[model samples]
Target: MFKENMHTKVGFEMNINKDDVTAPDVIALLQDHLKSMTLCSPPESIHALNTDRLRQPDVTLWSAREDGVLLGCGALKELNSRHGELKSMKTSPQHVRKGVAKRILHHIIEEAKRRGYQRLSLETGSVEAFLPARLLYEKAGFQYCEPFGDYNEDPNSLFMTLNMR
Candidate 1:
């Protein structure tokens, strides 16, 4: 469960690692992430994965921490030999706007590239609460796209993808 060190704009050294999703802090953060989803979207529209689903064989979760404090987490789920889905991306409430997500997002993109994935996609809420997330993905070069995999056209969901090749 170890990746590499990322130095932030604020000069703090953050560590991104392959996470097991068992640590108390990581579990607590995940609970908050799931609870937040409920506030903005109905159960039917919420696609964020729970802890059990996150541990599935096809998914790889990563955690970002600085000086032993958990800052954020994200996951990549292999949809096929050449495509992947970004899931459960969340930054701790106290760590928002601190570059934690940017670093983790960068790491996921690099890992997808390393895995020879042709594309990386994600589904986020279409509401205002998700504007920042959409902006982050857009800044990373992800573009609006049709839903991939098991997802269908739903007004509540916004799908985006990045071509890795």
Candidate 2:
């Protein structure tokens, strides 16, 4: 629960839960991330399979909140016994640079680890507009790599992975 225009109280409970991933909220977050990606690359650069796809049995959605406002949100898609994909990561424009992304990223990573996933991968952008996102991923221990899952090789996309072990 985030409070806009207010200070965050450290140790305040962040209600991170699965059911918080409402369709409307998740779609809004995806739209926001897509807009951010479009500023740097083509419209297709902001590719996310449909929200219905994320409704799969193996997919997990996590959201962060402080004081009732949405801070950031992300999803983890379990691929196999040891691998998971980072999907739909976004921080509200108002909350950017305020550690909201880091908090959500850490929460997703911990969730993946808790689920016994040994590896986590993500597909971001490869454009100047995405430097900050790339930096954030790197700061969170993600390293560049080739695209995985249904993604194909594209100079427009930057793929990264982290070893949860």
Candidate 3:
């Protein structure tokens, strides 16, 4: 029941919760993210996870809603006791540039810190269309880094990591 009234140009009552991923709005968001990723990267390089995968025990998913409108969603995947990864972060198309993604990202990073993770990392498409997302990560203190965990170097992918410790 975490709720915050975001006072921005598009001011909305943003509520963040670890809720069901099968919800209609959530499904739409995830589907849109997957479709967008596929458009920018090869199938083999698209790493966006499906709802079932995001529901795994190690992954904590949160959806942001504003007055019952799903604004965005993000997930923190525990990699180990001291590491975690950001996954499936997406904001509704209409909510873009309204601070929804930034709010969700801050929530995820705080959760990772609460879990005592020493590092938080993410993988995003290395394409022109993804520049905004990359800039968002950079603005949040994430720095370019080498591929981590099970990820490998791919020209279509970019890696970023934030030291939380």
Top of the candidates by TM-score: 1
Query: Clash pairs of candidate 1?
Result: none
lDDT string for model 3 (1-165, tens) is 223335766445688899668898898889899998878899999999998998889998999988888999999999999999999999998889888888999899889989999999999988899899998898899999999999999999999999996
Task: Go through the candidates in order and give the clash count of each.
Answer: 0, 5, 0
Q: Which has the higher lDDT value, candidate number 2 or candidate number 3? A: 3
lDDT of 3: 0.90
Rate residue 125 of model 2 by lDDT. Answer: 78
**Alpha-carbon lDDT, every model:** 0.92, 0.75, 0.90
**Model 1: per-residue Cα lDDT over 120-151, one tens digit each:** 99999999999999998998999999989999
Q: Give me the candidate number with maximum lDDT.
A: 1
Residues 67-128, candidate 2: write the lDDT tens digits. Answer: 77777777888889899998887777776777777677777888888989899999887777
Candidate 3 positional error at 116, Å: 0.4
Clashing pairs in 3: none
lDDT of 3 at 9: 65
Q: Rank the candidates by TM-score, best first.
A: 1, 3, 2
